[model samples]
Target: MTPTALTPPLMTPAQRKLGMVLCLVTIVLAVLDMNIVSAATVPIVRDLDPVHGVDRLPWLVSAFALAATALLPLYGKLCDLYGAKRVLLGAVGTFLLGSGLCGAAQSMDQLIAFRALQGIGGGGLMSVTMVVVAHLKDPEDRGAGRGGAMGGIVAGLGMAIGPLVGALFTDHLSWRWIFYVNLPLGLLVLVGAALVLKLPATAGRRSLDFLGAALAAAFATTLLLVTEWGGKDYAWTSPEILGLAAVAVVTLVLFLWRQATAAEPVLPLSLFRIRVVRLGFAVQGLVGMGMTGSIMYVMLYLQIARDVAPTTASLYLIPMAAGMTAIGLLVGRLTSRGHSPRTFLVAGAACATLALVLLGLSGPTTGLWAVCAELALLGCGLGQLIGQLITLVQEAAPAHQLGVATTGIRFFQTLGSALGAALFGTLLARVFEAGEPGEPLGAVRSLAGAAREHALGSFTDAVDVVFLSAGGVLGLVLLLAVRLRATEAAAGVGEEDRPVLAA
Candidate 1:
């Protein structure tokens, strides 16, 4: 039973406006959760491990990335098969529940599990928002409504003040407050999306491609597992690493093959055949790897390396946020004039790569202003590309399949983000250990006024090494940018799937 046209329009104007507001709030809550935890890492480790063994610590970040990436496409398909309004409301509910669990966590393992639970919701928050926005308007208006909405979402007041917000939660309130903070906001979004977001009914009996979902999840888990444990939990040459890597390769290949043939496939293979979707996803993957991976490290360097207080460290990040907002608005304006998105993609990737390379070479004594400038450049590059790609992906896709297609773009990028963090974090720890004075952990623990400052000198060098490596990755993203064309983006969806609603 294919869906009938239950509503004259796919969604109401009022619903669209309210949904956008709710979506923006979700992005803020989600992004804040990602960074706020970083500030709590050292303190949580100290409280749990007076002996200072941090073997299980990486799970805090890794779990969230893994769950979010794995669930992204899952939730996206749900939105397409069921309805965005239903899925969005469910996601917010789950996010609230997970947040409560995180606040109550008593052990490291419990916290990791709870965080992963939160990520399941976070995945829906991101993927559904894009689809819902696309459903609100015609393809021509996407840049103004969807792209502008995304820019505003990122440039929103909460994200603009995120570092400061996180610092406040970490400094005065308990670190648990960071997780608890989402409760009120999540509830608000839940209500808004449920009541105001009405979409065309999806009347068909949905058949999820379970085999494809399982294989994709298996592949993602295996890849992340090897990256997470390869250097830390076990030696890279160990059986565990080799076995996991092999399993990941086999499973991913199997997933691809299954997608090729499955009826009602989880990931429509035809999407990759569309030049815009392929190129857009490729650039987004590389950029996401570099940007998200480097986010926490940059903050760590500012607070630990430069010896700034949490408040001051958060304050310094304002410049980057400002740069992103400013550039994002400018690019948003450009999109209205029918400007080619390719130039922006290539230039943004190039600028980001340049900034990463420069920052990677900076030393402990490097001027604060200089570091800030490079960060601003990086932000500028990211702002120019982020909203543009998201909007383009949505535009290229047909209305009925928008959710699944958009989620694919986000999925690849998020997988890259996980790999980046795990790899870079392991490298940072190893380098810091090698360079530390005798009883390095103890020495770091004992330092007083400038204790974090002295410790950061070692961290600065390590971060530089990571940044340089990330720059190389961004080069590939730049190449993909050249392959993007407006015509390709316009043809991202198939002729058959172009309906405004499932009906």
Candidate 2:
């Protein structure tokens, strides 16, 4: 606690700004790589299996989702133990290696394996980047630089540009170029990480909990498979559904028991003691469920129901991103001033609910402008919630437990997405089975020149059902948001964590 120890080896303001910019660039690279591969699937499928017999197309996406979500906690724990810089650099290296493998894949199986590898790297990037941000300043100033660099630049730009960038590359160059795009970005991030990111090594006397990790993976895989395949590939009542549900229950219960007794558990059971963390996680889950269900169906409606081309449909997402970016930046400023976060969550969830209802009301008769308006509203609601929630989680928790706390919130978010897809998918299947007054699918089949028209009509009906369901869920989230508390972190906590250079 001496003055010399408290003093940072000084750097100029410009130097610190440069360091922060470089670190954020790493976040953008990781996030861009996360969702870009979706646009390259057509080229990959055509080259690897032109006949289209392989049913693993969805798996290519799902494999990455499962790997990334499941490994979040693992990487977060490693970051806390080994130092964020080392873990982040290692993850970036893995990501670059995976990207190279994906570009060179000769078959669908190879591509999927490579994508899984990419996810392993990506999982670490998201968690550790946030942790680095948390470590940069005491709780007070943590939310300041985050608005531009972390939230708007990294998350907003990455989410918006991913499909657009991927489309451009896949169209003009080659599908492989989408994967190849990561090389320069990843290399640059590696250099920035090596030079600027610094943290004291702090691995405690805990064994790596490999058993807990395997069990957690099993639980997540079973749940995801049940969600993905149930009601779509097989009946919900079938043996496959029942078996997977049983496995999920058993594995999750076993993991929970192991955590309760483990001397140093991977996911510490004690972190949930904070009421704010508990409520924040619950709100995160609900928001995730509503958002994912709504977005997926909207995309489906655009492409299948409206008959918009993939490139055009991707462009339509601009309103959502734009709205989110505007509101997210605004909220970041307000929340940094110690504004009550609960109010923002409630207002945002209400906005989302209203947007979903508007989408439901539109039916097939809605114009493109009307649909875009609805998307914009939903995006605005999301802006107030997403970036703010992560910042709140870090500020509310004890410093050393920051990684696990953030990972827990992320786990719930992933769970919500999986559940939303499964639940909404079931609703769509039921709506199809019940059918409208007329046979919509058959009418589409019977149409000669009107095939696309009737298909669009059926999609309209499905969207009506799905969006209405999402609206109801968001309304519930609004109610839950009322119970969430905005914890006031102590003043001067910021100086304790300030870095020599911006982390």
Candidate 3:
């Protein structure tokens, strides 16, 4: 939003606090929906359409991610045109509506469709909440991109706990409650928004690139479909996969062309000119992919490969959160004593990469404590890198373009996670099929003694490849992290506003 757009009223300190709390709640809602479904997938499939749902299960995850990611750039632009307050409330209401529909879905197709609808709302929750946050802060206190460093930590924490929450609901109540529970929480946030939020309104003045938004969403959706279906659902060379790939490439070219020519592009290509912004986008995307690998696949590893129950598997995240908390405290002191944020980034990436390597080296028979240690190390790495990347990007961007720049990095991150889910799914299926020929990963449940053990081993080995691939990607993030240069754009922030990740 334009800084001068209808100068916001002076809100009391209490009101500001309430507003910030509401924003965090929205973050929780978005991040939880992204993750909470994973733990309950088995039950949902069994109840919905067990016959064909097994083959379409990945869609349950991918549909939300794709729909959430597809319109991200446009959401940023919308916040610029309309105020954050209106956009945020609209998103929350839509998400609540979608949640209700998801709870009532009767078939796998219905559930996936509802998830996409929910994602249409979930898309706005994360990005727009940050926009609201920027408006809520005191002008002097306001830093970059809605002061998103802190939100990143909150998001990471939510990602850690979502499965546990999902497991608890699925264990004690039912999987449908996962979506139903959002209703009360979302309604509370809506009330808070209505009561306390004090933000500028800017609807009539800005030029929105409607066509540009359409092309961007089309490109992203097609790309994800190609990734999700290629080599697994269809042969890589088959007409279906080939046609999707062709559509993806053409849509991408058209989107780029439109962005170049549009009056107000959804994502301005000029932001990429800034080195910090460019590298930060790559860092966030790789981090998103790594986080997805760690959080999503770990449950699969524990539940299927090791035969652990879902609730017990979710408890394992406690170690990861503990590690992040410990490292966050240590980094707080080090940065205060005069350390570089870039130093932390490099160190964090190295640690996370090493942790992935350690995880990749493990087998189904590995001890629980040993795997926990690796998760803790991974958490330590992530705690350092996640929040700092966006803070750096927003600081580097020009103030007027803050909304798109902030949302743009998040857009890439969500896109990365979506692609990772699809790509990793394909890899897992192919590797498992190669070793067992005809047996699917799900067949381990029905096999006896030796066959079950062999299937579990093969599945674990396939998961190992996913971790190894993620590790190699993080190794690249480490390289980019090293290339970070200190600049005046970032130097403007006060010590209080700088590198709040550790704080």
The order of the candidates by TM-score, greatest first, is 2, 3, 1
The candidate scoring highest on TM-score is 2
List TM-scores for all candidates, in order.
Answer: 0.83, 0.88, 0.84
Better of 1 and 3 by lDDT: 3
Candidate ranking under lDDT, highest first, comes to: 3, 2, 1
Q: Per-residue CA lDDT of candidate 1, range 22-73, in tens?
A: 7778777777776677667766667655463277777887788788778777
Off-target runs (Cα >4 Å) in candidate 1 are 1-12, 42-55, 138-140, 148-160, 203-205, 292-315, 336-340, 360-365, 422-465, 486-503
TM-score of 2: 0.88
lDDT of 2 by residue, 327-437 (tens): 777766676676655567778888999999998887766799999999999888876666556766665665556667767777788888889988988887568656444
Model 3, range 289-395, lDDT digits (tens) per residue? 88877777887888998888977887787777667756666665565555656677788899999999999998988998998999889888887876667656755
The CA-based lDDT of model 2 is what?
0.73
